[model samples]
Each structure stands twice: as structure tokens, then as C-alpha cells.
Target: MSLGDDNGYGNDSGRTDDAYSTIGGTRQTRTRLPDGEGGDGYNTPRRPARASRSLITMAGVVVLLIAAIAFANMGGGDGNGNDGDGSGKGGSKPEAASTAATGTKPVTGKNGTIPSGFAHDEQGAQSAASNYAVALGSAGMFSTDTRRSIVQTTHDPAVVESLVAALTKAYSPSFLKNVGLNEDGTTPSGLTFVSRTIPVGTKVTEKTGDTATVEVWCTGLVGMAGPGSTKPVSATWFTISEKLKWVGDDWRIESSSQKEGPTPVNGDNRASTADEIAGAVEGYGGFTYAR
Candidate 1:
């Protein structure tokens, strides 16, 4: 699986200065009153009082506007604003650890490169599903023998026979050819067939003593890599939902299906050349993913 406005201030400042000027002008007018005029003769006009009140109201409004802007900038963390962290739920929950290292030990036992002997707990179930996703999405699936081994090893024993037959039919010679593989699922001469699934994370959707459903977010690279290759390797992100059963003392897939992605926005990184991609695929090994 592949895993995946501005503010104008110039006129406003002038208006603010005008307000201050009005208050200053009112004070200057008051100072100009006759020195010994009658007590009621120099009464300040209601206009100045109204202007003061209006100024207070405008200041209050400005304060409120500033507070609103600051609150918005702070995001309030109320689960409504998009923080763009890819949780897509705003700030409601801490971002799901899509690609963070879990620090959990990977499975030690393997059934021919497909992890086996999972612990039969929620973690184990998730681990099993993720690793199974990698196995099923690997270039091995294009071949007969490796595909059979993967199916038999990762699938529940009760359904292995049916799954093998079905998967075999699904990966027909025509399909292999379309993917730039030979009739026997081998890559053509001087070309490297790349089909690798890197799980970003796993979530247990449902779990019980003997059964569990897990979603593995994954990014996959598939196609042939070589000069002048028609099918250059490309990446795709998808989520694989696996229904697993505690069979034969370990988690095994009962059924699994894939959906297109919780894909992240593309970055501006330069795409690597075909040879570079092929070499990377060949050099770097995959991980045994856990929750």
C-alpha cells in the first residue's frame, strides 16, 4: 500500500488621527473660552460628547476586531479550523501518527519473507495486516510460486485454497504483460519490475478475541524500471482494509480490499530517475509495520 487575505491600514490610520484631532480640536475650543465667562456660558457642546462616545465605540470595535483576529490566528483548537496537518479533523485529535516510527520490535519469524507468528493481540493484528499488505502488494504477487507462498502463508488456512486460485486467476499472463512483465511474471531483460508497498500506519477498526479488522495506509511503487521502458515505475497511495482471523495461533488475513488514499498533498521534490528508483528499491529493504 502507498501511503500516504491582506489588511489595508493607511486610510484607517488617517481616520484614527482624525478622531484624535477632533478630540484635540474640542479641547482647544474649550481652552479658547473667555477666561471669566459666566459659569454656564462655556458649556461644552453635545457634539464633542457625541464624538467622544463615538470614539469609545469605535475603539471598542477595533479592540473586538483585533481580538477576533488573534483568536482566529490561534485557531481556538476547537476542531473546526483546518490546521493542514493531514488529520483532516481540524485540531480535534492529535494527528494520527501516519509515518512515525512505533519503536515496537518487528516480527522476528517469517514465512518466506512474509511475517508470521504474530502475538494475537491488537498490536499483533495490526502488525500482521500491515506486513501482509506489503507482501500482497510486492512484485512477488506477479509470480506464480512466490504469490502462492504469500497467499498460503498470510491468508487464513480455511480460505487459502480459494484465495490462491482466485489470486492466480486475477494475475493472468495478460495482466503481467500489461505491466511489462513476461509470461511467467519475470521482468524483461535489463528492466527491473518494482512493486513495493510501504505502509504508513495501521489502525484497528474492529477487534475481538479471534477476529480483527485493520486499515493499513500504504504507498506503493509499481512498474518496470529501465531505459526506454514503456511502463515507468509510479507511486500510488491506498488504504488496505484487512479482515484478519486468529488462525493457527497467529493472525492471518481472511479477506482484504483496497481503497484509494488518505494521500497527502504532493511536495515540490524532484522525481528520481528510473535507474535511481530501481536502485533504491533494490537497496532499501521493507519494514514489518506495527500500530
Candidate 2:
């Protein structure tokens, strides 16, 4: 591209900057001083003292930017295992950042269809809470026998009966109808019901000898998916707080409660059709989550 001498900073000008500077990862064109107010004669222009000074100033700014980037690039760990900028690498270290992955393996046992045999530790409590959240929000929870089985398997024996009764009432026939299910909680012949919870993260709020209070942040899909479905599958976010007790060599929920989310702004993606949503749920399997 040629911007003739009408602009004094043109290539014909002696003080042109041919290179671009990258700042904050984006390239920017170098700024040039405007044309000198007046010149010597027909075509011989005199560059003022300020023009030279401005060139020097531009060079100084470039140097400072380079130095700043070099400082940031030396992202080395300090003696105390933190980056010089006070952020850790957040990797496989004993004292990793609070939000870093712990690199623990998934639990290998199952209590019926739900995960079981969690370690008798804080991580175990968190894992149990997360899996229990999945169970409590699942399609199985909408059915009577399966709901009883899941409740009995995951909840503390002392509270199982009462919780079952309470949950049964909560999923009354009217409630089932409201969610687009049959009075008995079955989907219509051509429809598929989706009620699955996915744990986003877990945290231990209180831990002691044999009890732990864990809060699992979760997102879930719910409703009916099929042709002519009035209630299409939709997403929800909530936190399930589980009071866990270490029993039978594993963690079990003594009680659990839920609250509305730290919801995020919706994205611009188009919503899938009922059949598409139903097909994806059938095709994909959930993870055996680990902390």
C-alpha cells in the first residue's frame, strides 16, 4: 500500500516505521507525527526538532512494551511454589490452587446402579454427594419402585423411610402430570423423558469424624422430548447440599437439600428439536465423576 508524500510519514519519508507492534497479543500500526506545519521550498521539507524527539519517544515506548512482555513471559515458579505473579501452575502438586483438579481416580464400585465404595475421606464425601445428586435428579426418581430403590441405596438407613415418604408425596400424580409424564410417571408411547443431573463441581463445607457436609453444584436436563410434546427438554442449574455419613465402608447421604443456581447468561445457540434432544440423550453416556 502506498500513501504518497501527501502524508509525511509515507515510505518516501526518512523516518517511517515499517514494522507493527504487538501489544496484549494484538498487532497495532505505529502512529506517526502529522505533517510539519510548513517547509523550506517547492519540495524540500525540513523535519523539525520535535519530529526527531517524537521518533525517540516512540522508540522508548516500544522498548518499555518489550520489557513488560519479557517480565510476563518469565512465568516461573517462585521458591514457594507459586508463579512470581502470585498465581500457581494449578497442576499435580500437593498444594495446588483451590480450583485445580486433584488427579484422583474414579470410584470402582457400585451400589446397585449408583457409584459406591468411595474412600472414607473428604474426597469420598464429595464424590458420594455428587453421585447422589445424579440419582436424586434422574428419571428413575420419577418412578415408584426405582425411586424407592435409589433412595434406599443412597440415603442413610435411618432417614430412608421418611425421605422416601416425603419424595413420594412430592412426585404425586398431579406433579407427574405437570411435568408432562403420565399419572404414574411414565412417558407417552412416542416420547422420551429426560431427567439427569450433571455435577459441575463439589466442595466440602464441614467435615468431622464420621460426617461431612458437601455441596454439589449441578446442571440438569428435564422434561419430555418427542413429537407434539408441550414440555420440551430444558436445562436448569442448582446446588444440592448433602449431609453425608460414612457407613458400611462408604459415604451415604443422611439428608440433602437444593437451592437455585449461580446461573449464567444464556448463549446464542439454537435450541434442538425434541427428537434431536432425545436422540442425543440415548446416544451419550454420563461420566463416573472424580474430584
Candidate 3:
């Protein structure tokens, strides 16, 4: 179900509190209209053998359609997996920059005396942007104090206040209630709330000295991953483009925008039980992302 500001997937500047549930899986089954009346206790007219042939033909058509869908899914949507691969543009420079470069590394220097240094070059900037995106889109952003700290620390000083205000309004009381969370961002009893963005890859779409715009095409794991949980965590893919500026010796996000991904189909992995999933979340702590 989508909730709480498109789950922070966009920058449209409005609180869109909407939620939806997928009954079974991501895809919904088509419901067929039931027969109104059974052919009363009498034998219905025997249809011609040709009618049976038509039914068989119809079934064959459906089978072909299903096969096509499966084949397409097997290829996956080519969503950006740690790079611009999902963009359907092959040999793109940004996608290949990291691997193609022989001897280049991010220039790390103290920015505003903050702990983590910013990447100095375009390549470094792209890497930094990708990792930063992961942290911002993480589940930790849901907790009240943590969320505030994250916004303040991760965002550019020039934009932090505005972003915070917008995020504050977006994650309002009503919004939290709809997502099954309290006004203070606490999870309901016996349920764990989860949200995290996993960066598949980074690409420097456009760059210049000390300032560049990089797009981190990412596949994120979100939702509550646990047992007896009404809202089990799920995944979503999107591209977050960030404009970065070298400030006090570091790259910082000045402004940003998000777009829906070239999402792919679900793989054939076995679905774990709720208890097992919950245990995994508790047992595992996410990483401090870097490109």
C-alpha cells in the first residue's frame, strides 16, 4: 500500500495521503462473472463439436498471452541496477564511468567540518549522491527524531529548512495514522515498521567542476517486514536525481526530484514467513551506503 507522501518518492510539495492494498500479489486476478442460473435439472442442448473447438482455440490464445508475459518478465524490466541500466540506453557514459575509469577515486575532504567528506570530482560526486540517496530513502527516516536528524544532516544547508518543513507537513499526524503509525512515528504494538532505499547504481548524468547533477537509479525495499503484520514490507524502484554543489569542500544536495522507475517483475524467490522476515529486520542493520 502507498502512504505518507507517496512514501517520500517525489518532491511535488503536497501531502498526498493515499493507500491501496494488493489482495494477493502485485498482479490482481481477473474475476469472471458467474453463470446466473444453472441449466435447471434438464440436460442442456448439446453444443456442436465445433463449439468445443472454439473453446479450445480461445484457451490456446490465453496460454500464448501468458507465455509472452512470463518471457518478458524473465528478462526483468531492466530497471536501473546500481547504474543507468534501466534507462534502456546502452553504453551510456554515466553508467560506464566508474568501471571505465582506470585511476580515479572520490576526493574526500571535510565539508563545513562535518564528519563524512564529500566527493571532489564528478565521479566522486556521483558516488556520493548515490550513497546519500540510499540513506535519505531509508526506513530510519520514519522515526521522529531520527527523521529530523537525517534531514538536517543529509540535506544542503541552503535547502534543509525548506525540505524539513515540507517533510514535516507531508508526514503529518493524519498521514502517520493512515500508514498504521502513531503521530509520534512509533510502530504499533508487536509490529515493526520498515523503510529503506537500496541503490542499484549511480550515474553522472551531467557534471561540471564543483557542481554536478547525478541520478541514482535505485530499487528500494520498503514497508513493514514482520509477523502477524498487516502491512508487510514490499519493494519499489525509482530514480532520484540530485543536484549537488561543492560546499566548504564537500558535495551536498541542493535540490532534487524523483521519478517512477523502469520497474521489473518479481523473481522466483520463496516468500519467507512473517516471523522470519521480522527476525531478519531486527537482526540486520542497514549499511552506510557508498558508491
> Best candidate, lDDT-wise?
2
- Candidate 1 stretches with Cα past 4 Å from truth are 1-103
lDDT of 2 by residue, 102-133 (tens): 78898999878989888887777777766666
Supply candidate 1's per-residue lDDT for 227. 62
Local accuracy of candidate 3 as per-residue lDDT tens digits, 1-291: 111232232222222333211100010100011112332211222211111011100000000000000000000112233333322233344433564542544335433222256457755676666555544554444455654565455456865554455445545577566655777878777776555455565666555566666665555443444444554444455455566678775677655444444568766666665566677778887454445
Itemize residue pairs with steric clashes in candidate 2: none
Model 2 TM-score? 0.66
Root-mean-square deviation of every model: 28.9, 26.4, 15.2
Residue 49, candidate 2: Cα error in Å is 69
What are the per-residue Cα lDDT tens digits for candidate 1 across 189-277? 98786655666666666666798766565655554566655555544454555667788788876644433446687665666666777
Task: Give the least accurate 10-residue stretch of model 3, judged by summed lDDT.
Answer: 62-71
lDDT of each: 0.46, 0.48, 0.41
